[model samples]
Target: MKRKIAPFILIALSLIIAVGLSACSESGRNVEEIRIGVTGPLTGATANSGVASKQGMELAVDEWNEKGGIEVEGNKLPIKMYFEDNQGKPDQGVSTAEKLFNNEEVDFLIGDAFASSVTMAIMDLAGQYEKPILSGEPVSSAISDKITENPDKYKYFWKGNVGSDAYGDSVYQTVKMLEESGDFQPTDKTVSFVVEDTDYGRSNADEVARLLENDGWKVVAYETVEVGHTEFYPQLTKLGSLKPDLLVSVFTADSSGVALVKQINETKLKTLHTAVYYPTRPEFIENAKDSSEGLVWIPLMFEPLLRESQVDFATAIKEKWNVVATPNHALGYDTMNNALTSIAEAQSLDSEKIVEQLAKLDRDGILGRFVFDDSNHTIKAGPEYIPVPAVQIQDGKNAIIWPENISTSKYQK
Candidate 1:
């Protein structure tokens, strides 16, 4: 009986030891793969911008993988991207977010680059799952406001580009500069807005109208169009009838922007056509053809007038993709690079830890020096950080025309 009891005790001890060793191994295991999920309008009206952003993110990921990937806890972890097309719809965006978080089990997430409505729809999921989102190009100020209102609830959301208010202010500044330079003068001192009927477009148009009204410019006509609306002749005709000094368009769809610009040009409207965020794409020029000429656009960053460091990145993207990099592309590259840096700083793959490091990250890249505002979780927009670059289409080329220091050409009518 004593011998039997002794054998049983020894077996029990061995089992305990094995369990301890297994736990230790699991705790110290190195991350093998870092999964990143991306959502965008890859197959809808805004597919051009979404595709460009994906290319930029892919370029950054490829570069890191070529360099043996990101190092974590003395082990190199390769990046794996899982891309989902939101198709520029709010419901689809939420579903895509759920798939990335639940099915794919991605460690990080990026994008929803084309539509602000889609970005806003996914914020609830980001908060619920505690996954950090480095948004690519969604510019609605509502996102920042939500984060600011509830820091803990929406701390995971960070804007990768300027907010709508900043964009509006930038457009205002350009108009003021033009006014001062005697390039633009209206007998009526009036302006009109033709905006997409979405959170992004409406918010930006409201901000621009507010600023213009404050500056003593009368807003003559304000019209809203659906997201994928192609026929803009009615809106353009109404705006033309107003005979305002300037026509500000806030369209996310490249097709809409081209059609509107072409119609405005063909109708010979005297109002100066300026857009917020749409005309920065190379496809805009290709689609609009000569109609895009003389159109001014407020871009988050202008690729042609990028800083030296940014120029290198632009060159790399152009060579690899055989297409010019737009502001969306720059935002994508910067967002991914920033995420990689934050992961390294956190020294762990845990989502919460990555969020902690991201809150404190302040670095410079293609989009210039970036530091998220503590309250809003958005990159501060000013001269010192990510200032808006106003680009104008001149002779079938997009050229910087504002912030004189970076201007490649004067404002062309």
Candidate 2:
């Protein structure tokens, strides 16, 4: 009878061991299951930019996860991202944020490539949920500062790119450098700024105006009109009277750029200087045909070989994507990388700690040495413009005309 009781006790102990082993297996799985959330205009007017950004994010994540993800303490984890299409609408973006915060339970967040207005709608939500949001492409200065205004409500958001005001400041530097180099007369001071009637346009126009005034330059004219104004001749007529030495037009897409250049060429403004954003693209030059000649634009970044590292990166990215990578792609890559690195450093799934680590980063990644300012979560990498050479359309090609080292093909004058 004693032997029978001893056998029953051994069977019970075996069952308990089995249950404990199963629990351990479920609780200690690999860290690759970390989830990140991403939102963007994947199916709307800004779809091209969205697609490029998505690709950059996926590329970085794929590479990182392949390397066993980032190391936290003694364990390596894997990262998985869940992306939602915002359709480039504020309402859609808000819905996506809701899903990410409530249902998906993502460890981190990214994007809203347009501006602060789009980011603002979802920033508070991220903060309320205590989830870190590493911005992908919004350039407005307010994206970061808004958080500082309401620290309790927006403590989890951080910027991983430059602000919109930086571009205007860079343009100012370009103008000053050109004048000092004797490329233009110091009296070539009359400047005209024409912007489309949009939030981005308004902010850009104001910044440019303020910058020019601060620099003691004569602002010949400052104007804003609806984006789809096909006929720019009326405005061109007014600008012509101002006798501006420089014409700075910020238009979007191929159609608007072509229309602007056609109006400029037909009006015969004889301004001797013209600069525009969309017109700098290859498609814009092709659409403008001969009218694109002699247009000087300042690009935030370009794909041409300005330096060894840049040339290599541009060639590699272009070969992979079959098109030039815009600054949007750079922002996307940096944002995702920063978010993932923050996750590794935090060593926990808590968003509050991740945000803190991101704000303290001093690492140099694809977008160069960058660190988000603690005061406002703004990334400061110094004002480094790509120095968009004075490229002119000549003999069926856009050729550079400034800085002897980068002048590959001279303009056919």
Candidate 3:
């Protein structure tokens, strides 16, 4: 569904345009390059995510530059990147955004941290400063809810990803389908959750739990841990004791995900295991290998083994960066491409035109089609827009198992 922009959102758009005009860089100036400031955890626990995002952004930049750059006012302006390391800290994210605005004077910004805490920290900079921001990851529903609740406050912000609820829906439907197909049977209708202690983690955990509870499943245990906390033994031990039929883990760190898999095996927590976010990274399989066998996860977008388009994008990324591409890389690539497409379509740096063009965009990327729900300035999720399929790691490869029409393999446990 498309968003019906309220009057306040229009007013907010006007404010963004007015601010953009006063900012000079987004106005009639001798602009040689489109300065884009990028934020990612380039040097912390999630450095792999940061690096992948950087590579994706670079790929997008190369594509636009190869096309002779974005034409505006008879001048082709190339994109120049100003990437900063947030280290996955909220404070660092805020400070990094400030630096980008004050020092680089970037015409646009992209957030790649994929964490709600970090995205929320830097969201206001779009309005407070004179630029518009688009984010690729960070799936917490709270971000969209906030924009919906206070449109005027977030008028200059846009999210290129679907909300956390999509993850919940994917996991819930996966479990339900597995049961319906007689591939999964439970002694008791019980579910457990272990997630990072952040909005993204807690939000996904609560959403999936809510769906299962509504379906008559009892909640056995709900555990939260700090980001990068690898000590799942305590939580795994508790889960083993309870023996919930399903255990869902949500985290963003590669180490945390790999550690969870290894420890779950060590603890022999036999409950059917599912996950969100982390397992999509290639390092998870490289690091976890056999331990991740039969693990079901959601939201597979850029698995090279899944689609020819995926393989094409992964091949380009490998040729460019010498590293295997992950779903996060696809997200970052699509996010940047969406921004550039809108900017070029607008033909001017006017925030009003760019934002309008963005809301009307209907394009395809490595993930799937890109269409925003104008109601809340977030991407639509599902089969028709973006398919959020459930996947299982079998023999160190991605085997899509749920959403049967797109399933390449059946669920094996």
Better of 1 and 2 by TM-score: 1
RMSD of each: 6.1, 8.8, 9.5
Return the number of clashes found in candidate 1.
Answer: 0
Instruction: Please give the lDDT score at residue 317 for candidate 1.
Output: 85
Superposed by TM-score, candidate 3 places the C-alpha of residue 197 at a distance from the truth, in angstroms, of 1.3
lDDT per residue for candidate 2 within 338-360, as digits (tens), equals: 78878878887777778778877
Tens digit per residue, CA lDDT, model 1, 200-276 = 99889888889989989898888998886778778778877789998899988877888888888888888877898
Residue 62: error of model 1 in Å?
Answer: 1.4
lDDT of 3 by residue, 339-363 (tens): 9998899887777788888888899
After TM-score superposition, the amount by which residue 206's alpha carbon in candidate 1 deviates from its true location, in angstroms, is: 1.5
Better of 1 and 3 by TM-score: 3
| CA lDDT, candidate 3, residue 39 | 88
For model 1, state the Cα shift of residue 11 in Å: 31
What value does the lDDT take at residue 225 in candidate 3?
90
Best TM-score among the predictions, by candidate number: 3
Off by over 4 Å in 2: 1-32, 71-75, 185-190, 217-221, 225-231, 251-255, 272-290, 302-304, 315-322, 383-413
Specify the poorest-scoring 10-residue window by lDDT in model 1: 22-31
